[model samples]
Target: MRTYSLDDVYATCKRRDSWWTVYFVDPVACRAALLVGNRTNITPNAITVFSLVLGMASAGCLAAGQLAAGAVLFYLSFMVDCVDGKIARLKGTGTPFGLWLDFMGDRIRELCCATGLAYGQYAATGNVDFIVLGVAVVVLDLFRYVNAPQMKRVRDAIREANAARTPPPPGPHEPLPHQSFSHSPVPHQLGALTVRSHPVAAQPSRPPRSRKSRRRLLRRFNKALARRRVRTHLISGIEFHAAVFVIAPLLGQAALIPVTSVISVLFVANEIFLIYRMWLFTRSYSAVPKPEKSREHAPIGGSPNV
Candidate 1:
């Protein structure tokens, strides 16, 4: 077994992670990954299974109305979840099955925990609102997971379509002004005349943009966010889960509804903003000029027959 150092473990972590993970979970998880990587024969899949067990135990505690213990167990489960990925990265022990297990396990854990929290609250207070909130939690989580990947695919498809319509860059072997070719079409071609064998159409130019245009403003905002390593969507699935499972419970039953409601609103708003951005992208993509069909024996230096 190969040994790994602390630095090696840290190196295996993602460059950018959710704020909750980066600030709270990572410091502890990095140490855990290093210890596990060097000292044991444990597989990443085993750690993942262990995380699932912790998660289920957490759900049981929550169901039993042991809110404090449940919160602690839930956080521990998240830490273990972070560890498995780090170990996989450090030891190169990751598998496709491991990835699938991790993803599905997260969904199940959240579902069970949501049900546990809501049921426990309802049992104590006889309120139906908690039960409805539980269903909303599950639905929103599923929607975010389902929609995020499909949205990515749509964006990828749009990018590919745009790329297909764009002209390719010059080949490595293509002659530049500074370089000369051995074989010349013109025997004594010199200076600028050596470059072109055929006449290429001049690219159309667009008018300069106003400083206050929506596109320009968006670009500036994006650049500012990038500089800080911050995403426009501040609250993601990880944050949402943490808020519901950890923060809400720590604050007691009274805070649960308010916390969950706030996070849900933010999550939905971000998703809507993402969809709006995609709409803008599609509009721009549609506006791209398509190549017109050429007429038979068209003049090289003149317009084609109308």
Candidate 2:
């Protein structure tokens, strides 16, 4: 067990639970979700399904030319999105599939919203405004999807680096028994096992050579790598939502067009920043040598990689 081993920062993130736990006002929500999740076997994926239904319904409202209603539904959709993850964490039902679903849901929501809005407005009047803005919508999506992978790579790199920077707790495993004890009065060929990690001191600690240290370090490394991935995916997906959310409505919210337009511009800036963040992760990830030998891969923003 080596002293340089890194801790699982992402695990801490997961343990923290509640989607908005870091942002406060979520402790109460987290407790409630945990209570419900504990009572029922509802996994994170189940909540995702609920979110999807609400989102689709909102999209339906938007397509039916109910802008205000659509807006409210959209808000609920976002809230559901937040609640499900928190519940998953509270229930300890966060699985890889659930994570993937959550990620995909966000992109789906963005795509549906902008595309549906375009569809709705066009069906109503076949206006040039919707037609013109459609180009922007497609362009934004293309960039969003295409850049996601690169961004993810960068995030992975960052987590790995961070984990290395912050070491993990030592393992408690005992060492293997010794082959034999040759120091007897009658030198016997028979050997005995060495007591292991339970009482670590008597356990002849192995340093990088130490089993406990190595295991702990390895775990941290993997978590860091995972964190990089989750963070990158989340940021890019969020950017997509931010774009569609602000710009698509700008088409009909003529009074707030200027404000919305500014937001859209900020989305572009966000894209650039995200790309930069990805580059950081990539550099950090590659800095660690071979993939198999490297530490646990953590997700970005303290989440573990799914």
Candidate 3:
């Protein structure tokens, strides 16, 4: 088998990941990935299966009311989960099936863990509220996953529609076309609201430029994050999972309810923030320029041959 350095392993890591994994897990996982990649022929799918087993074991421990053991297993499961992808990227042996399996495995792990924690607590205290919390957590997780992709699709569709309607820039020698902005309204459904889109009125054509100061600020921010290997989304799905499975559990069983409630509220707030951003984005559609009629496409001669 071929060997790779630590730099190679780091290069294969995700550019942006959760702070927990970027700081705590990757330091260990990258070394493990290198060792596995260089010393063994173990495939990424195999590691995914192993991680899934660990996750299942963690769920079993939680269900049995073994909080400390469950916490340890859960963290180990997540760390190993992080490793498989790095190994896949390093080895270049990833497959579509592996991707599908990994996704399905994560979903299964989350579902099992949530149910186990709820059932164990309910069993211990005879309180039904834990069950309710479990169901709500699962629902919120699903909402986050489903909502993100659907919203992204809507944004992509909007951009594509705008691109199709907007005409290309004219050549230097080409004369300017006779132009008039259309006031025709195109109905677009944004979430629950259905509104009409009206392109902006004609204006002086000038080269578009973004503020250099703003660009500089953004560049600096990205560089700072890149140094640590994370992204702007500090409370993404990974963090949510860590809060519920690892952090909350480790904080002791007495703290579970409050911690879970707070994390759930944060998740809902994050989703609402995303929707607000999308609403703001819809405003840009009104700025897409309407296509103008160009004489360049007409026949060269005065009239067509009859």
Clashes of each: 0, 46, 0
Candidate 2 lowest-lDDT run of ten:
1-10
| Model 2 CA lDDT for position 189 | 43
Better of 2 and 3 by lDDT: 3
In the range 200-275, model 3's lDDT, one tens digit per residue, is 8999775446676777788999889888888766777787888888888898888788888988888788788889
Model 2: per-residue Cα lDDT over 1-306, one tens digit each: 111111221222343232223333243334445454446666668778887887887778767877666766665676667667766654456888888999889767766777766677678877767655555666777787777776776576668666786646545674334433434344434356333222234756446647877888878876764644333122343444543553345345552234345545776787888667666646654455433432357645564534
> What C-alpha lDDT, on a 0 to 100 scale, does residue 20 get in candidate 2?
26
Please report, in order, the local distance difference test score of every candidate based on alpha carbons: 0.86, 0.58, 0.84
Please provide, for model 1 over 1-306, each residue's C-alpha lDDT reduced to its tens digit, 9 standing for 90 to 100: 777888998888786667788778989999999999889989999999999999999999888888888899999999999999999988888999999999988888999999999898889889999999899999999898888898889889888878888867668988665466445564457865555354378998765677448778888987776664556577888899999899989889889899999999998888788889888877877754556767666788777754
TM-score of 3: 0.78
Choose the strongest candidate by lDDT: 1
Best by TM-score: 3
Ordered from best to worst TM-score, the candidate numbers read: 3, 1, 2
